[model samples]
Target chain A: MIKNQFYVISLLVILSMILVACSGGDAGGTSESSGGSESEAVTLKFFHKWPEPEHMEFYEFAVQEYEKNHPNVTIEMEAVADEPYKDKIRVLMAANEVPDVYFSWAGEFSWKFARAGQALDITDAVMNTDWKDQVILSAVEPYKLDGKIYGVPMRINAKFMVYNKAMFEEYGISEPATWDEFLTACSTLKENGVVPLAFGDEFPWAASHYVGDFNAKLVGGDVRSADYLLTAPAEKLFTDPGYVEGLARFQTLVTAGCFNEGPNGISHSSARSSFIAGKAGMIYIELEEFVTVADGMGQDAFGFFQFPSGSGDEGDQKLLTGAPDGFMISASTEHPEEAMDFLKFITGPEMGKEYVKRLGIPSAAVGAVNDETALPIVVKGVESINTASGMALWLDTDINIKIVEVYLPGMQAILNGTKTPEELMQEVHDAAVQAQSELSQ
Target chain B: MKRKFLNQLTPYYFLLPSLILMSVFIYLPVVENFYYSLFRWSAIDTTLNYIGFENYTRIFTDDLVGLSLFNNTLYAVISVIFQVFIALVLAAMLEAHLVRPFFGTLFRNILFLPSVLAISVVGVTWQLIYRPDTGLINQVLRAVGLDTLTRTWLGEEGTAIYSIIAVSQWQWVGYCMILFIVAIQAIPEELFESARIDGANAVQQFFRITVPLVRETTLVMTTITVIGAFKVFDIIWVMTAGGPNHASEVLGNYLYRVAFRNDEMGYAAALATLLFVITFLLTFIQLWLGRTGKEN
Candidate 1:
């Protein structure tokens, strides 16, 4: 009798454990299926890549305000840092645990997810609604693929040559408008014992930005797009000599002692620190970082210029290196209506103005980042992005990732002086060919 | 007969939970990994194209695979030299009473300090220490007027792998030494005393007794070091990210890059399968050699 009681008790314990293990998910499902009434109480899972305290402050405020307004909805939020977020999102998608709303770059990065049917098609919701008029059209353009929008742009970002004005004036250097003048300025800075450019290829994306900018100016937009989309024929695919010339120009910057030593060893933040401390003359920085620069070096100390154009006119010199980063609703969300509502609220004009004021990023929402809400430099940056002929999306995101894999490391090798421009281009050409084949498949 | 059967079944009943967990977690995924390896798939997409050993063929021909394998081999060999062999000598010295009592504990604690640190922390700390301009190593070299000897420790192709391997040694050698120390402590002191009385010196007794007695521990440590070397990912990932053009790429890092970064799930599955085979074969060989040595 005692032994039988013990067995019965053990079985009961195991059953209870299993029940406890499964209860949380079951409760969520039950709540989800209860009703779509106003008091139904929906839980939306939100994921984003900004976990930094500064960004988090804005995000937390936005979430709280949204939740307060919609008492029936609750947001379960999760955030990861930028780099790990890229890997983590894929894992989550693979595990079928994608959050209802998430952050994504508005390029091949988000396009891949959209192509895989993992992202919701928000085209009708964005275009048919008043949201279309609220955002800058240019910023919203990148989110369109195959004539449908998959994401809503939140911020407009672009790269610029931000310099310490005091140091530049101390060395009698002015903003360069041409490649030759830029090189001369670098030489002058080097002679003055200041690092002309604070370049860090540790992440390699920093180098890719330069190459992307150069390629845009040298290779032209249409040809580059043809190559990027792998729509060009085999003979013309990434075989442009201008591609080699673009890499060669970057190599010239390296050979001219235009950057800090062992750039491949340094992190971008460390390089930014050197620039902020007046140890480096200038850095190619994104507009989003202008606020951080202002905070570090006082609002009046720094000035910005577009990356100087080379003498070549093969490409549109007015093309700026940048794209909008935005948010997407997952296709698998159980609460699509609620998820879309939250995305609209978070990316709307009010939150966008708050984004600029609090987080210091230029908002994609039209007229959200005036002088009152943003720093003077940020206002100028937004104007530049607005007036540019077109935005050159980041190389790492704009191009096919397989090709990016080659371009990034190949650029690092150029920084390391281990591979020549011709050699690197050959590798890039081969990768483009492979990408073309994969596209056909 | 019923009681006997019940007694016999009790051990299996006790093991049932663990066995089920292992099947669900470890064994199931491994089988699924092999099945997925034969198909071209992406993690985000629900499409799977049956590609039948094409990924395996690609792995054999891939230059990155060859480079990663070479790096893994280099790591294993170096780890064996430092963590296994050198740690054994250090453990033997500690057990031989060469140091005073107070300092012995101090030294052991100092040696084991790094192993307790998180791998991410260690990788980050070493990255700061290996910076070309402001890093500790370079700063020290410049301070002593040995600037020529200073190099980008974790940046350049020539130095990145070696620098990462050195950090691995710094973190793991102590742990391996502790294992050796424990094994050495378990040996009878009377054996050493008898050797001493038989006209054997410290070196002679160490070779004849301590070394022989700790053979099993040495085998275990060597196998662990080798497997750990092959499985290295966090340090390399956090530090160089298998760069200045993949100078420090290993199998695990390459697998992760292909799977998550490139979204090539099938190819990554193949790479994972290859990694498992390599580790399994090496462990089998080591254990087989150990058994043969015991038999002899």
Candidate 2:
């Protein structure tokens, strides 16, 4: 029995040795084969957040096209849904294993990765190449922090008030021209037993746009970011009285019964549905979503208007609250040039044109959108972006992530009447100061 | 003597691989999490910044943490009562009917249905039911002329946490019922027969005989329900996302937000360790009580 056991153990050891030998041989063979070739084989890992059926078409096709053009570079693509994409990127960043080319939102979101030395400072690649002239400068600026470019813009989006045209006509009012007109319109609608804003604070960012637009309009886009990013000196720390005023303006809307009943309980989709179904007069939603919402509601039901002009502060109120989504290359990538090439090829005018021509999303690559394929309402929305003052990135995207995390729930508390705006903003100010001190340390 | 010595080590040889795996994957991560709990860190940092006990101090001082712990405590207390006492009543009724009735398995299956369903699916389904505008609750209230009583079940602060608790009870009560049924079945018929002969009524026999006999099973269910209550994330995450400014936030949900959303891994680790210690002490106390109850 002991002899039999020895024989079995020897056999198992032989089998394991064979397996290891085969794996080693496989690696050796691949390197040898590539060594003989003129085109050095390099594999690039590409990660993106466009896993939806409709969205995947162009991206998959573009990857294929890029690979065909660059036989030396092989692109491996992994597309994930949005929330999980953001989450997995953080985990990857923690492990120091970020993908070579990955989706990034411009402004403070991308700045976090850049500050960590994860993202490549691709100023030369973005600015020196013909691609520099292709993307809009406003779309390009958010990716620039500390006078260095970290990413290239892929898509530009703005938040606009999409009002139900039928509701507006029936109420004998056009789109509001100023803050007072907007409040008057809301009060009139509420008195007539019509819900004015089909909005919910359940998705806090959806509610934050009111404060975001109001902040930009009141404090100006530049000062908003300075305070939001906590770049202000330690003594100042987002203490502008205008910050409180902007929040108070939002609270005023809640007090005026502008939103649907139990706004905190409902979801974004529910609010959008209510507006489309004519249960409410207006909704403030992202500009990119206009095409989808209008198509769903049948374009005749609604029309787009930018958030009304606020007269309370001495700033250019014409600026739209908006940001662009983009792509960045990892600093650790072995093939930085190849990754930059991929980013450029995908985010250039052709891809933007394809996006606009096929999907009707307004592209950051200027003049890429063909107005013919888009609905007239979508065309109108695009026209507004072209004519507008400066664009302010989304509040959550502009502010330090930790501060925004605190601010969102604070905003929700204010909207729900659990806390006053003064208290919430005070909490936000404290968090901002804490973040600033940490950075200083 | 040699053979006996070899045999003594055989069970350990069998357990070695799994024991190593458990130590590496489970125990190692737990140790690392504890170590990390001492520090402050952010997404941008290459390494943990050790602040030593500041996170724990924050948990004690932070109102959100207080609220979260309070919510979790309510969940544990409410869920255990429903899963143990109420389920026992249900198990008795169903087990009695199980012998003579045609609809016995059918009723049991209907009750057990929610347990079989995925928590996310159950959350989504309940979301529709709790929806204020066209939801079944408000619709029924309006139909019955009790419209004034209608309020947003999942949105309002007062109702949100309880609304989620109701979902938890609905899903788990049947699982506990099944356990009770098995324990009741295992009880010998002769004891009950003697109780009946002694002029004990149904309630008397149930209280004197069945209740005392199922103490161990009751303890098992209690432990399971209590631990499950503290660990609940998926249902609450999907249904409310600890929303409307954290009206429904529990410790587990708050830990997730602290870790992922705020990118405060150290603070999250601290919160997790706190939860682990609390769960451990509570479980030890429970098991101790169960043993003492048996001795008595």
lDDT per residue (tens digit) for residues A174-203 in model 2:
888888999998988888888899886666
* Model 1 spans > 4 angstroms off: A1-30, A33-35, B1-11, B193-202, B289-296
Model 2 clashing residue pairs (backbone): none
What TM-score, to 2 decimals, does candidate 1 have? 0.95
Q: What proportion of true contacts does candidate 2 retain?
A: 0.49
In terms of lDDT, the best-performing candidate is 1
Residue B255 alpha-carbon offset, candidate 1, angstroms: 0.6
* Candidate 2 Cα errors over 4 Å, as ranges: A1-38, A220-222, B1-10, B97-100, B193-199, B286-296
lDDT of 1 at A107: 80
DockQ of 1: 0.65
